[model samples]
Target: MKLNTDASVGEEGWIDLGVVACDSAGRVAFSAARRVRAFWPPEVAECKAIHMAVRLAKAQGLANVIIESDSQVVTTRLTTAALYFSDLDTILGDILEICNGFNPISFTHVKRDGNTAAHNLARAVPFGVEQCWENHVPRDVAPYVLMDTLSLD
Candidate 1:
């Protein structure tokens, strides 16, 4: 499974996080979203989204996954082994710790346009609410998921 993650920060300082996990055929395995009031930077928010994605994936019994995000910094940090001094160290460590149980897990950085489903979910969910769906996504995200499925054809 491949999980696409994204984050949208509202002007009021609330960060909305989204995660959409799909199989190779672009079928939704599960989708999740949450809104939190945090003033973290974009990269930090993106990292948090991935962390949330991994946690949800595990909770859903997804044993293998590739966590994809638009933040190059987070993906690069997770993909590379070199240690860096920054705010991400703890978050990265937490993510890596969670990966021990999975057989093979990876992280990738994709363009924002390619990750519209997750991007939409991040913006669509209301503040102070968290939601998750299995086997399908809500109406707002279904179109994007359908577009992605068609693209694979």
Candidate 2:
């Protein structure tokens, strides 16, 4: 499975996080959009998005997955297993722990343009709500998902 994730911060300091997982054929496996209270920086929000992706994959019984994010800092930290000295340390640790549940998992950084599906999903999510789609595409994110499938083809 390939999971693309992204996060956006609203003007009022709320964070919208999204994760979209697709199979080799580009079929949507799982997708989630969540609103989280703001306290940390954008990098932390990115980490949250990725952590959610790992959890979703595990819940769906996927043993191997490649998690992609548009945030280079978050991806680099996770991929290198670097020890962060700040509040991110805890979130990073949690991400690493989540990875342990999978037989094989990898993290990669991607350009924001390449992560449009997750971007749109994150942007569309209303604050204070957590919505998820499993085994099918949500109507609001369908166009973006189609674009992803086209690009993969």
Candidate 3:
């Protein structure tokens, strides 16, 4: 599975985390959006998105996945030996722990332009509830999914 995650801040200053997983065929395997009320930086929010992504993958019984995030800082940190001390340390630690469940997993960085599906999903308003879509994505994200499919052509 190719899992992509992103984070957006709503007008209410709520952090919205979005995660989307697709099969090799570009079909959505699972997607999720969550709204969090916190005063975290964008990088922190991105880490939370990744955290949620890995946890959700475990919940869905996925044994392996290539996780992607738009935040270069976070992904770079995850792939490097040097851990910068900050709020992200704990969250990154937890993410790495959950990542152990998979036989092999990877964290990659994608440009914002290439991750529109998760980008738009992060802007979604789930009203303090974490919304999830299985076997498909919400309507708002379908166009981006199609865009992704076309790009892979």
Residue-level error in angstroms, candidate 1, position 110 = 0.6
Query: Which whole-number lDDT from 0 to 100 does residue 40 have in model 2?
Result: 65
lDDT of 1 by residue, 1-153 (tens): 999999987788999999999999988999999999989889889988999999988888888899889999889988884457778787888888887777789889999888999999887778678889988889988999888778778
Supply the global lDDT for candidate 3: 0.88
Tens digits of lDDT, candidate 3, 17-47: 9999998889999999999888888888999
Q: Model 1 residue 70 lDDT?
A: 95
Model 2 bad stretches (over 4 Å): none
CA RMSD per model (angstroms): 1.2, 1.2, 1.2
Regions of candidate 3 where Cα sits further than 4 Å from its true position: none
Tens digits of per-residue lDDT, candidate 2, 1-153, equal: 999999988777889998989998989888899988787688889988888888878888899899999999889888899975788878999989978988788899989888989998887677678788887657888888888889876
List TM-scores for all candidates, in order: 0.95, 0.94, 0.94
